[model samples]
Target chain A: MTETAGTYGTEFFVRWLEAVAEAVEREADRLTELDAAIGDADHGANLRRGFTAVRKALEEEPPTAPGAVLVAAGKQLISTVGGASGPLYGTLLRRAGKALGDDPQVTRERFAGALGEGVEAVSRLGGAAPGDKTMLDALGPGVEGLKVSFSAGRDRAGEGAAGTVPLRARKGRASYLGERSAGHEDPGAASSALLFAALAATARAEAADGTRTDGEGAA
Target chain B: MSAGRDDDGRGGGGMSAGRVGIVLVSHSAGVAAAVAELARGLAGGGDTAPVRPAGGTPGGGLGTSAELIAEAARAVDGGAGVALLVDLGSAVLTVKALLAEGGELPEGARLVDAPFVEGAVAAVVTASAGAGLDEVAAAASEAYTYRKE
Candidate 1:
């Protein structure tokens, strides 16, 4: 079938969910490793549980719309996980889901904008600035990077993840570390980068399969 | 990565056909028990999916003993697979050790790092929905990494 515009079908969104789950599973250890340095060292473990729940929910009742999938995932995160990251991260997904609003397919521009909204929600909830050395340190720039890469016809999720270094944490557990958090990358940021990377990878794969249409209507 | 058939033989999302179970491990048995209670509450009158809580045994060793965790893992892996979730620090280490000693993890078996609140909520929700262990595990992990916008 000829790929439509920026919109993705249920299958595509499901793939996105799966990719996210896999990414979290693979990197859970790394996240905990980072958190251990400054915070309680449970970021990895906490996230692993949340995503596992999301995946299970999806399996039971797969949503038809991309937004619904995200919304459901967000709800699962908020209810199943605990700790500061739970609410912060849950709010982000919930916000993204709201922004998506039942759209079955999302264009590159639209998805990027929605993600930006999600990031903004996280910033507001956490009360952290760009260089606060929290997940935002990575996500703020990661979202910006996605915008830029999408616009430039390039994918730079990895680049954004790499940029989280040299920042001081202003909120969350890491914030307590003061200047100590400056040098180390934020665990949240690293994970956020994975999210974007998964998105980019999904889009690219679809595009390669000729399942994605290019240009205006694709939005 | 097969999305195996559900109980009805219908190919839903990636749900497996085998029976599903839960394995909860925490530093304190109280914590694990609390999680189980929450799961039961959320489960309502629906199918009673097996939820094995480890680590909080009454003995003096630790809240959750390594042996208890291994047993829980084994129970979950009997059929479709088991989903493992734990609290912070040593609790996590304890569960990992149990998994290592528990022999091969079922095809769909997995360990989730979800926070106490979110992870429990997610697991309960998934169980109530009749989701398989693998699916529930995926949700727990996703919830952990989610950020609000």
Candidate 2:
């Protein structure tokens, strides 16, 4: 959204991570408010702290590979972020990182596959299925859309996140609320949608930059 | 994170040889340490088996940290392996993430998903008496059947 370009290398992930950080910061208060309805009301503060550490860690070490960056960020979240979100998100990133291997360049298909692995890790760790009003709901749609196109993936992810509003939570703290969890959006699903939105934004920015470079060459 | 915690000459700080160690994980650092202290009393008082507390974030906030847990796991490991007890959701996930990294655990190390306080006390007491890794883990898991009624 800020016109920052995405590329083939790990830089895309870096940009995506930054975009998600910005998006999360913007939605932090809202996320916490949503949590107040069915969770501990720490979702915003928790992710804010986690992403801040991730940005700091990346700046400090500056990994070359996309997988390395994910692994690094995931590890940071696991240690700095509290609650089940830390581990769940951490496992998602770390597992996806492992799936990507050490490849510096990634194809869209490969990235999609890797993301699927990450989403699966989240599900496996949390034992939450679709219709459970969890992050997986958003991530599941995002991954499927990613296999189609980046922008579509993000759009579907946002829709999936919003769709959780009317569902009853069946996992995490919200599960304790039973039927009361209905009519409220899941904080995890919201944050998860932000992540997919960041990915799509990064991709658009990259395309814009590419067009600019081509025009400059023709000129 | 660093691995292979220094093996103290004091048999892991007064712990007997070949004993299974206990690790306590929680979102609050103070809570984990306090629980460890209380559990130590119930286990065998001070100088009992190696009991380590992995709690909070590196910045001392209320959150679970895989890095801290990994370090604690390494430190608490004796020859017989370690049994880990976690408080809640993220705590369990954090430990699983650390293990999922594919690092070689200390022989027979494993995570036990049981009530933090009760499991830690039970596992600690079992380990202090030279219980095996499975035995210690079982003791912690067995605490799941405990009830206030």
The C-alpha lDDT values of all candidates are: 0.66, 0.81
Question: Individual DockQ of the candidates?
Answer: 0.03, 0.71
**What are the iRMS values of all candidates?**
12.2, 1.6
lDDT of 2 by residue, A37-114 (tens): 999999998999888888889888888788888898888787778778887888888878889888876766678888
* Candidate closest to the true structure, highest TM-score: 2
Among incorrect, acceptable, medium and high, the docking class of model 1 is: incorrect
Model 2 residue pairs with clashes: A79-B65, A82-B63, A84-B90
Residue A54 local lDDT, model 2: 89
Report the error of model 2 at residue B70, Å.
2.7
**Model 2 chain A lowest lDDT segment of ten:** A210-219
Instruction: Assess candidate 2 and give its TM-score to the true structure.
Output: 0.89
The numbered model that scores best in lDDT is 2
Give candidate 2 regions above 4 Å deviation: A1-7, A211-219, B1-3, B6-16, B58-60, B104-107
